[model samples]
Target chain A: MDATERPVADLPAQRDGQEVIHLDRVEKVFEVRRRAGLLRREKREVRAVDGLSFSVGRGEVVGFVGPNGAGKSTTIKMLTGILTPSAGTLRVAGVEPARDRARLARRIGVVFGQRTTLWWDLPLLDSYQLIHRMYRVPDARYRENLDRCVELLGLGDLLDVPVRQLSLGQRMRGDIAAALLHDPEVLYLDEPTIGLDVVSKANVRHFLADLNAERGTTVLLTTHDLTDIEQLCRRVMVIDHGRLMYDGEVAGLHRIAEVERTLVVDLATEMAPIALESARTVKVEGPRQWLAFPAGQPAAPIVAEIAAGWPLVDLSLREPDIEDVISLMYAGRSAG
Target chain B: MAHGPGRAALYAAVAAKGFRRYATYRAATLAGIFTNTVFGVILAQTYLALWAERPGLGGYDQAQALTFVWIGQSLHMAVAAMGGGSEEELMERIRSGDIAVDLYRPVDLQLWWLAQDAGRACFQLFARGALPLAFGALVFDLALPASPGTWIAFLTAVALGLLVSFGIRYLVALSAFWLLDGAGVGQLAWLVGMFFSGMMLPLNVFPGLLGEVARVLPWSSILQLPADVLLGVHTGTGLLGVYAFQLAWAAALLAAGRALQSLATRRVVVQGG
Candidate 1:
C-alpha cells in the first residue's frame, strides 16, 4: 500500500513480452427505444461492436481505422471501461477494462480528439497538477514528465493560458500532453489527428513516433487520416459495420483495394478539363478540378505534366481514406 | 482505506481544483451574492410581519425568525440542496458522452464528485453566504449565538447538511444514466427540496403532520436543523441528537447514491455511440 514510497523497480515485474491489449469475441449491444410514432415506441438492439477480436503486443502501434458509426468509438469506450461489453473477453494491460476499470486506469492513458479531458476553466498547468495528484505520480516523476511534455509538445507558453482560450491545435497538443503525464504503459488515441492543420498534424505524429520509440508506449490509434496510419502505424486494422473488414499491413490494405488518390488542382482560369496520360478527371468546377490516380501510382509525374501544360494555381493531394479502402474492398469482392 | 493518506491527498487536491474553478467565476459569484442578499432582505421582512402577527409562532421569536431567513438565504447557495449546480453539468456530460473522461480516472467516481461538491459548497459558504448573513444581522437584529462553541457546532451542522444535500443531488444526477435527460427529475427534486428544506418557510412553522414529516426528511438537515442549532433551540443532548439525525441521513443518502452509481456504471449507455 506504500505506493508513494515504493519505486517503480520495487513493484511486481510484468510478464516478459506480454500482450498489452487483448480482445476475444468482444460485442456491445445497445438497446435503443425510439418513438416510432406519437405513442408507439420501437425497441431495437444495436450491435455496435460485433464479436470483434484482436490482440496487440507490447510496444505495438496499431491503428484502428473505421468510418463514422463503424464501432471504433464503442470499442474505445469499452477498452476504457466507459461502457461494458455485452459479451466476450476484453483486457488491457492484463486487466479487464470494465471489471477493473480503476485499476487498469493507473496503467493506461486515453485521448479523444473530439473532446478534451482538461478542466475547462482552469489553466493548463492547473489541470496537469490535478492529474498529477489524481494519478499519484511522484513529485520528481511529475516534474520530469511535465518538463518533457512542455519541451516536446511546445506547451511552455501555453501552460499558464486557460484551456478554453487555446487554439484547437494548441489545445489538442495540451490534451496529448495531459494524457501522457501519468506515464501510462498503454495509450489509446481516438482520432488524434481529426481536425488539425498540416503542421500540427505532423507535430503530433512526430511526437507520437518519438514517444513510442523512447518509452516503448504501446499505442492503439483510431483515426480517419490514412497518412497518420501510414506514418505511425505498420499494422492497421480496418473495421466496418461493427465487424473486422481487414487486419494486416497498411500497405497491403492499400494495394488490395487499388484505391485511387485524389489530386485536387486549382487552375488559373475556367478552362476545359485537362486530359492527362496517367490521371483521369473525376469532376471539374470553375477554375478547380479533381483528378483520380491509382493509389499505387506516383502523383509526381501527373503533377509535373499538369503544371507544365495547364496554368496551375494551387494543388493538394488527398490520401485515400479508410472508408474508401473498405468500400473499395467490398467493391472488389462483389466485382470478382 | 489502506491507501489513506494518498487517497486523501488526491481528493483534497481535486477539491482544491474545484474551489479554484468556482473562484474563476468572479462576476457570477458577485451576482449570486447580490441576489442572495436581496432575497434575504425580502424574506426577512415577510418573516418579521408573520412573527409579529403570531407572536412567538413555532417556538421562534421575531429575531429568531429573522435569523432563520438569513440562514436559509445563506444556505440556499452554500448547501445548494434545492438543486441547480454541478449536478446539471454532470447531467449534461452524461448526455454529451463527456462522462467518458471522468470514467477514465483511477479515483472513485462518487467520492470524486463529493469532493468537488464540497469544494464548491465551502467556497459559497464564504463568498455568497456570509455576506447575506452579515447584512441580515446588521439590518434586522437577528438572533446571535453568544458562545463560540455554539458557532462551532453550527458550522459542523452546515458541513453535514452539505453532505446530505450532495447525496440527494448526486442520486438525481446519476439518474441520467437511465433517463438520459435528468432535467425533469432535477426540477422535481428542486421542488421537493424547496418545500421540505425550510427554505421557503421554516419547517417548524408547518402545521400538523406536515411539520413532523418535513422535520424528519433529509431536506431538513440542509437548512432547518442547522438553523435550529444556531438559534440554541437544540441544546446539550438534544443538539447531539440533531447531529446524529443529520449524520444518519447523510450516511444513508450517500450510501444509496453510491449504490445507484455502481448500478448506473454497470449499464452505461454513453449517448453518442
Candidate 2:
C-alpha cells in the first residue's frame, strides 16, 4: 500500500511524536444548482475549504475556530471521511480517511453537536449496545468503557431513558459516550457545547478536560464559545473564507488579530472626553468615557494617561475578548 | 490493533436491533394488521361476486380464488416492505444529513439497511402476516397447499421475494442521493411495483399478452410467483423454474442496488440537518 493507505499498525514509529492527523493543501468545492429564472437554471461553485493545511501531533488538543460558513464544519467532515476533498491529501492515524474510512473509523470518534448519533427511539443503554455491536467492541472492553463513561459523564440515571426523552445536555453526553465506546485514538467534537446550559456546559468541559489529560487522546475541537477554547485547548487555529488565518498559542491570537483592549473610566462628575496619546476615547458619556488602545500596548500607560486627564472615580481595564479578536481578524482580512 | 466485535457479530447485531426497533411500535403494527385484514375481506367479497358472475374466472376456482385473496393480504406486508412509501426511512436519513453518520460506520450501507429491513420483515411476518391469513381461514373456506414440499417451496419463494423487494426499495432510496427530492420517483416506483407485483390483481387475470408481459417482469417474482407456488398453480419442474426466476431477480436487483449505492456514495451531498 502507498504511505497514505498504510494500516495504522504499519505507521512509522514517532521520531518526534509523529503527527496523528495531517492535511496537505486540502480543498473542497461544492457545485450548487440554482434556478436562474423561469424555466432556467444556473450552476455555482462554492469553495467550502480552500488549500487548507495543518497537522496535529498525538495527544494534542487543537481548537479550530472560525465564523459560521467559514469551512469549519466542512473541514471536520472531510477529516472524518464524511466528505471527500476536491483536491489534496488527508491522513488520520496514517490512513486516508476517504479511501479507508472503515479502517480509519476504528481509530477515530466524531460528535456533531447539532446531531445525535444514538438511535432516537431507543433508550440510552440500548443505543450504546447497538453501537457496541456496530463497532464490534468486545464484551469486556465494552462493559469497561460503558462503565467508565457512565461514571465520568454522569450517565448512570439517564441510561434507561430514551434518547428522545433526554435533555439536550444529557443526549450530548450520551453521544460522547457512544463515540468513545470503541476506544478510538482520536476525537473530533464540533460545537459540543452548543445550546447547553451553564451547568451542563461545565460538566461537558470538565469531562473533556479529564478525558484528554488522562488518556492523552488527540482531540480537535471546533466551537464558537471562546470559553471552550480557553479552557480546553492551548493551541488554536483560526480559519476564514476557507483559509488558515492564524495558527498559534491561544493568547497569541489577540496580538495577531490587532484588536484593542477597552478602558472604561467613570469620572467623578460630568466632564469632556478623556484625551491621551497612548489611547483614544472611542465613546463618551456625561460622567463616563471608554478608551480603546492596542491590546499589545502596555495597559499601565493607557490607564495612567486616562487617570491624569480625567476626573476618574473608578477605572477598569478590559482585556481583548476572544470574540473581538476573531471578528477583528476576519474584518482585517476582508478589508485588506 | 483491531478492536470491537467481528463483522458477522456486527451484522447480526444490526439485524437484531432493527427487529427490536420495529417491535416497539406495537400500536402501529396493530393498526397495519387491521387495515390489511379489512382490505382482505373487501377484496375477497369482490372476488366472490366475480365468481358468481363467471363461476371460473381467470382459471381460479372459488376455493383457490378465496385462498388467493387471503394469502395476498397476508403477504402484502412481507412483499411491500417499503410499507406504502418507497424507502421513506432511508430517504429521510439521506435528506436530513443523518446518512453522513451512517456512512462513517464500518458496515456497508446497503447491507446494513437490508439487515434492518430483514428485522422489520420478521416482525411483520409474525405480527401482520399470520393474523390476516388466520382471519381469512376462519371467515372463508381457504384452500391449503396440497403437500409438505409445496409448503416448503412456497416459503422459500416468499423469502426470495422479500429479498427482491428489499433490493428494489433500496435502489429507489438510493435515488435520493442524486435527486435530493425523490418523492416523485419513489411514488412512481410504488405505483409500478404494485401494478406488476399482482398486489392490485393477480397477473393471470390480465388478458393474453399483457399477462405474459407481467409474468416476465421482475415485479411478479416479488409476489405473484410466490403466491402461484403456494396455490399449486405451478408444481415440480415449473415450481423449480419459479424459484430460479425469483432467485435470479433477487440477485440481479441486489447487485444493481449495490452498484447504484457505490455510485451514489461518490456523489453523496448530505444537506442540512
Candidate 3:
C-alpha cells in the first residue's frame, strides 16, 4: 500500500520504545504574498516539505541533511509541532505533534545552532532553573540530569556567567544542557556544530554519542557538516526539494555520492600543473594548484609526489562537504 | 506531573527569572529613570500653564494636574503604556525563527510571557517609577491620598493596568507571526497606546465624543482609570466599577491574544532555519 493511500486514522498503535518518530506523507505548504509592484500583490504557495515520509527508532542517531531551502528545517518544525503540516500526519513518542504539542514537548528536546533559547541577560544556571520548573521535572531527577549535563558539557564554570557574556560555543553548550534538564526521550539538533572550533565540535559530538549510548535518546541531527555525520550518525537521510533523496548507512552515502578529496598545493614558484598519476589538477593559479582525488584513497602519496617532484611550499587536504556530496547526487540524478 | 502548587511555583520562578533578566540592565534602568523624570518636569510645567489658564480644567486643580503628570510618568514604564520595551525581543525572536524554541517549551506561551512581563512591570514600578514621582514631589506640590486603603486600591488598579498593557503588546508582538516584521504594528500600537492611555493628555480633558471613547477603550485602563482611582476621582461603587472595567478589558484582550497565538502556531512560517 502507498503511504499517501494510508488512512489518516490508521496511525500505528503506540510503539513508544521502538519507533519514537513517524511521518506519513507529511507536507507543509506556505502561502507567501509578494508585492508585485506599488499596489499589486502576488500570492504563491511554496511546498516547503512536500510529501516527506520517514521515521527514526529509539537509540538511533540519524543525520538529516539537505541543501539550503531543501525543507529539512520545515520537516523538523513539523515534527516538533512548531508548524502544522498542510497534509499528511506526524507522530513523535506516540503523540501527534501539532495536536498535542505541549504534551509532546515533555518527551523531546530541540536545539537551534543559529539561535539560543537561553535568557541572554540571566546566568546560565538561572535559565536552567527556570527550565526545571517549566518542565516540572522532579527535584531529584532535575538535579541528576543537571549534574550530568553540567559535568559532560563542561558547564561548571559557565553556570554563573550571563549568557550574553559567554562565547557562541559556551552558549550552545548551555542551551544543550537546558534542553536536557527534563530527560527528554528524543533530541532534534539543527547544525549543533555550525560555528564551533575543532575542540568544541569534538566535545559536542562526544557528548551526543554518550547521550545516545547511555540513555537511548533518539537523535535526529540536521547539519551542513559531513564529519558530524561520519562520526555521529550511522544512518543518514538526505532530503532535497522537500523530498527524501537518500536514506541509508553513511558509508553507502559516500559510495553512491562518490565524494572527492582536494589537495590544495602552494608551490614556491608559479609552474605548470604538476604531473601526477594518482591525482589530476583541477585548477591552477600563481604558485597554487588544486588537485582532485578519490576520497576513498589516501592523500599521503599525492602529497609525497608533489613534494618530491616539484617545489611544493605548503599543501592542505580539503574534504568534500555536504554541499559537494548533495550537488554530486543532483548531477548524477540528472545524468542517469 | 507537576500539579497545582508545583505549576504555580513554576510560573513564579518564570516571573522571578523575568525580574532578574531586566535587573541586569542597571545602566538602562538608570537612563530610563532620568528620562522619565525629565519628561515629568516638562509635562508638569505644561500642565501648570494649562491649569492656570483654566482653573479646575478636567476636574483637576493646578495641584491635581501636576499630580497627574508625575503619576503618568511613574506608570509609563511600569505599565509599558506606549508598548515598546521588552516585547521588542519577542518580535525579533519571531522574525528570526527563534520563537521555535519558545514553542518547544512545555509551558503555555501566553502565560510564560505574561509572567515575564509582570516581572518587568514590577521591576520598573520601583526603579523607574518611584524615583521620578519622588523627584516630582520634591520639585512641586501634588495631590496626596491620605489613606493606605487608597494606596492599595491604586496599586491594584496599576497591576490590572499592567495586564491590559501586556495584552495589547503581546498581540502586537505575535503579529510578527503573520507580518514577519512587527515594527510597523509596534509603531501603530505605540501611537494608539500613547494617545488613548492618557499619556499625552488626560482622557477627562478631551471633549465630548473623544473623551467618551478614550475613557472606555482598553488603553484607558493602563493610565486613565488607575490615575483616577489614585486621585480619588472614583469612590465606593465607582472604585469597584473601575476595577471591573479594567478586568473585563484585560480578560477580553488576553483571551484574544491567546486565541491569536493558537491560530498563529497552527500556520506559523518561521522566517529561517
Candidate 4:
C-alpha cells in the first residue's frame, strides 16, 4: 500500500528475541505553522524521516551517520518510542515504541551529548541511584552494575559532584552511567562525542568500543564523527533529507570512492605542460600536479606515457579515503 | 498496578532532593513566594475595602473571608502550578528522545509523577506558597483560627483539597499526547478550576445553577473546603466526606491520565528531532 494509505490502526511494532530495533517503512512528519503576523497562519509539514525500514541484530554495532538534521535524531526517537511517526510501523525490544513507549523504556538506554539526562542539581551518584530504583534494578544487581560503571567510566571521583558542577566531560560520563544503571540491552547514543576534547573523545570512544565488545550489547550510534564510524562500527548507514541513501560495510563505501585513483607528478622543467585525456585534473600546486583515472583507466601506461612525453620528475598514486567516499555520497544527493 | 506509600516515598526522595535543588533554581521559588503573597493581599484588600466596616458579607465573616484568600493563594503555587509545568516537560522529552530513559522505570509513570509531584507540592506549600501565606497574615494583621481543633481540621482539609487539585492538574498535563504543548491548556484548566473552586470569591455568591455546579466540582475543593475548616464551619463527618470526595477525584483522574498515556505511547513514532 502507498504510505498515505497505511492506517493509523496498524498496531504497535512487534518483535521477537533476536531483533532489537525495527522500522518498517516508518515515516515521521511534524505539523508546523508559519505566522503571517499574529492571527494569520500557514500550516506546513516537515518530513524529518522518510519511509525508513531496517532492523538491528542483537550485539550489532551500527553507525547511523548523517549530516545534521538529516533526521538522525527523529529515527532514534521513533526506535526508542519517544515520538509517534506520522507513517509506517516501528518496533523495539519486542514492542512498538510509539505504541507502548513506557513499556519499552526499561529495555532501552538513550543518551544525547547535547543534553544530560541526570538531574542537574543532584550529585551524579544520587541521580544514578534514582534511575537504579526507577528502572527497579535489583539491589545486588544495581550495586554490581553501578560499581562496574563507576569503575569502567572512572566516575568514582566525580560521583559526589552535582551534575551542574561537573565539567562537560564529567557530565557526559555521569549521563552514560545514569543510562546504564538499568543495564539495558540496547544503547542509543546521539552525537556522544560532539564537542569533546580529543582525550575525552578518545576515552569515550574506547569505553564505547569496549562496552560493545564485552557485553555484545546492540549499539545504534548516530554521530557526525567519521573517526567514530571508522573505529567502532563495521557497518555504516548514511541518510540525507529523511531518506536512507546508503547501507553497507565501511569497505564498500571505500571501494565506491576507490574507483578514482589520484596520480601526483612533479615537473622537471619549469615550463613543462602535461596533457591527458580520459582523466581529470584534481589539484595543482607549485611544481606538482595530480590527475585522477576514471576507475578502469590503466595508471601504469598513463604514467609511462607522462614520463616519456612530458618533463615529469617523479610520481605517486593513492586511493581515496572514507571521508572522500561519504562526501561523494552526500554530495551526490544534495545536487539533485 | 497501583500507587502506594512506597511509591510516594521514592517520589518524595526525588522531590526532597528536588527541594534542595532550590539553591540553583533561578530564585524562582522566592519570586513565586512573593507572587503568592501579592495575590493573597490583592484578594484581602479588595474584600476589606468593599466590606468597609461590615463584619460579614455573603455569610462569611472577616475570618472566613480572610481564610479563603490565604488558602486560595497558597494553593495557586503549590499543587496547581507545579503540575502545570508537566505539559511542556512532557513535550520536550518526547521530542528529544530523552524520554527513553524515563520509560524504563519499573515504577508506573503515573505513580512516578505522583511521587515527584508530591515532593514539588510539599516544597511549594512550605517554601513558596504556605510560608508566604503565614507572613501575609502577620503583615496584614489578619484574623487567625482561634481553636486548636480548627487548625487540625484546616490542615486535613488543605491536604485533601490539594490531592484533588493535583489530580485535576495531572489530567490536564496529560493532554500533551494530543496537543504539542499543553501549558496554555493547563493554565486555562487551572483558571477554570479556580472559577468553580471559589478562588475568586465565595461559591455561594455565584448564584443559581452555577453555585450548585461549583459545590460539586473539584475546584471548590482547592480552597473552599479548607477555608471552611479554618473558619470552624466544617469538621468530623463533614471533613471525612470532603476527604472521600478528594480521594475519589484523584483516582478518577489517575485512571484517565494513564489511559491517555498508554494510548499515546502506542501510537508514538519517536523519530528524528
> Each model's TM-score, in the order given?
0.92, 0.85, 0.90, 0.75
**After best superposition, candidate 3 residue A87: deviation in angstroms?**
1.5
DockQ, structure candidate 1: 0.67
Give lDDT: candidate 4, residue B101.
Answer: 52
Q: Please report, in order, the local distance difference test score of every candidate based on alpha carbons.
A: 0.87, 0.82, 0.86, 0.72
True contacts kept of 1: 0.84
- Per-residue lDDT tens digits of candidate 4, residues A1-336? 121222322312212446777888888887778997889999998998889988776777788987777888878777766677888988787888766755677788888888777887778877877776566778898999899888988898988887889888888887787778788889999889877775777788888877877776778988876667766776678887899888766556655444366788888755434667756767777788888875334467888888887887888765433346567866765875
TM-score attained by model 3: 0.90
Q: Compared with the true structure, what per-residue lDDT tens digits does model 2 show for residues A224-306?
A: 77667777776789888899988877777755565576889898998877778888899988888888887545667777766
Clash pairs, candidate 2, are A136-B4, A136-B5, A137-B4, A137-B5
- On a 0 to 1 TM-score scale, where does candidate 1 land against the true structure? 0.92
Question: What is the Å distance of residue B237 in model 1 from its true position?
Answer: 0.8
Better DockQ candidate (1, 3): 1
Q: What TM-score does structure 4 among the candidates reach? A: 0.75
Which model scores highest in DockQ?
1
- Tens digits of per-residue lDDT for model 2, B60-103: 88888888888788888866634542278889888888788888
Candidate 2 vs candidate 3: which has greater TM-score?
Answer: 3
Which candidate leads the pack in TM-score? Answer: 1
lDDT of 1 by residue, B251-270 (tens): 99999998998888887687
Error of 2 at A71 (Å): 1.1
Docking class of 2: acceptable
Task: Give a tens-digit lDDT track for model 3, residues A170-281.
Answer: 9989888888899988999999998898689889989998888778788899998777887787778999889999987777887778667789999999999887899889
